[model samples]
Target: MKIKQLGERALIQRIAGLLSGGSDIVVGAGDDDCAVLDTGGDDHLLVTTDMLHRKTDFPEQMTARQIGWMSVAVNLSDLASKGASPIGIVMAMGIPPDTEVEFIEEVVKGMDECASRYGTHIIGGDTDAHDELTIVGTALGKVKKGHLIRRSGARVGDLVCVTGHPGTAGAALFALDKKIPVSQDILKALFEPVPRIYEGMALAGTGSVTSMMDISDGLALSLHDMSMAGSVGFRIYESRLPVLPDVKRLLKKQELHEAAVFTGGDFELLFTVAPDKIEKARKACPLTVIGEAVEKGVFIERAGRVEELKARGYEHFRQQGQ
Candidate 1:
């Protein structure tokens, strides 16, 4: 009866069933961060919001500025996956009354810097007092009618590809927990992640991307999501996984591989394209082809064998043991 027993995904399904979508709504909840809405124009409007709590999201090593940047970056990443041009961002903060004004100013500075980097600005928001620190950001963006990418367009035989690599953020988290030494690059990967905005837009312009989504939930879960949305399956080769060479050397083989598949926090784009259009897609955007879509269930091929892919990535309620 409670959320803990059902898990985040199940709870979302229940909530989605109760919600009614209007004709103006292009894409609603249950897929990505933003809900696409059509306003009888050549372009569709995208609305998305993301919230981060201090207890769960903020790391001890992160400063107020880093937290602020992350709060905005996460939402922008969602818009990027839709190949949308950001309109603006509105941020709401729930800060403790005792918090220093300087700290809050630094947070705003961080948000402004990150927004400027993406060619967007923070328009307005509300502030409130709370027992703990909470930051919420709502972003608005727009995508041309036919250019908007979704998670459901992937077809069988489509080539699955990803922008950049994975495992750096995951490995950083591991090192932080274990008190292991890590390079500045690794810390940067975890503290300040770069969203694939230009890459997503380029891929969308090529008209070759089928299903597209940000791999914030890890590669294995992201593939599962694409598979379910497209009503197809996927078979990714382990040898084809993209990971930084430094990470591979620092972590054990199994550890790095597991992080590549199971770690969340990476904001890279994972998308698919038709086999015939793979060359065009690659020309438009640099990405590594890791696999292809199949007819049925999701799988991964490794060491000359194949196995069913499991969703072992982050789950909110499950992770909290709620």
Candidate 2:
């Protein structure tokens, strides 16, 4: 099969499968990112690495600073989902030797802005020469005892909620690709995503929230992960999903159902809270109740018919490339 047909995610899975691993791993080689042991006293460390290839992650017209900012933000966002505070960052950078020094400087500038904004420091990093540009970010975070929310703690009867709106980023991507006109506001929102640090901090000590994850790949797939990780089913009400107008304008062939249900890049938080604490959660922070956890299998209510929720989001090792 062609390389594109196999997709980058698939290629990674295939490569990952070919290797054998050792025992230093607390959590290894899967999920939104990876976590390794710190061996420090009384604290569980979270280590996540994200690599952004220039062509894959950003357009040619995008700014280097924004690219750096997003790279750090994406990793920090993962830490927030698990209720961790970022501590330090290390980077492995590769770029064509001919690349402008100013571009490289801007990237570092953006990374510094994001790091300082979140109070995380870039302690160490490396640079290498390559034919194409790539940035690999490794972030370390710490979570207090009993505060780290896993993908496996969701229980039946827990209410499922998400922070902020969905589908805007995906919509923006489609609009740009199709040469469709989108408002400047949406374009900016799409190019630059805000990680939900406030909502994440609020979830601390929230006894109601059982399981949590960031909606990185897509809400549908993220929800699917919670179901599998927690061993519970999910019942999502599509009617309750929040969507931006920019997304609605781009839904030409697919109905609103498809756009809101499967599109990714929203970067919001997907979490499960207990029924009793729903009101308390609302008072404490902003969220939308899109569904509840069930006993088995995923179900979605749409068009007045309740049917099984299919796998509609991107999968790393799926049949073929996107």
Best by TM-score: 1
Q: Summing lDDT over every window of 10 consecutive residues in candidate 1, give the lowest-scoring window.
A: 313-322
Off by over 4 Å in 2: 1-26, 31-42, 249-255, 315-322
For model 2, residues 225-319, the per-residue Cα lDDT tens digits are 78887899999987788877666766764545655667676778899999988877787578999999999998888768898987567554354
The total number of steric clashes, by the backbone 3 Å criterion, in model 1 comes to 0
Task: Estimate the Cα RMSD of every predicted model relative to the unseen true structure.
Answer: 1.4, 3.0
- What value does the lDDT take at residue 43 in candidate 1? 95
TM-score of 1: 0.97
The local lDDT score (0 to 100) that residue 52 gets in candidate 1 is: 88
Task: List TM-score per model, in order.
Answer: 0.97, 0.88
Evaluated at residue 120, the lDDT of candidate 1 is 96
Best by lDDT: 1
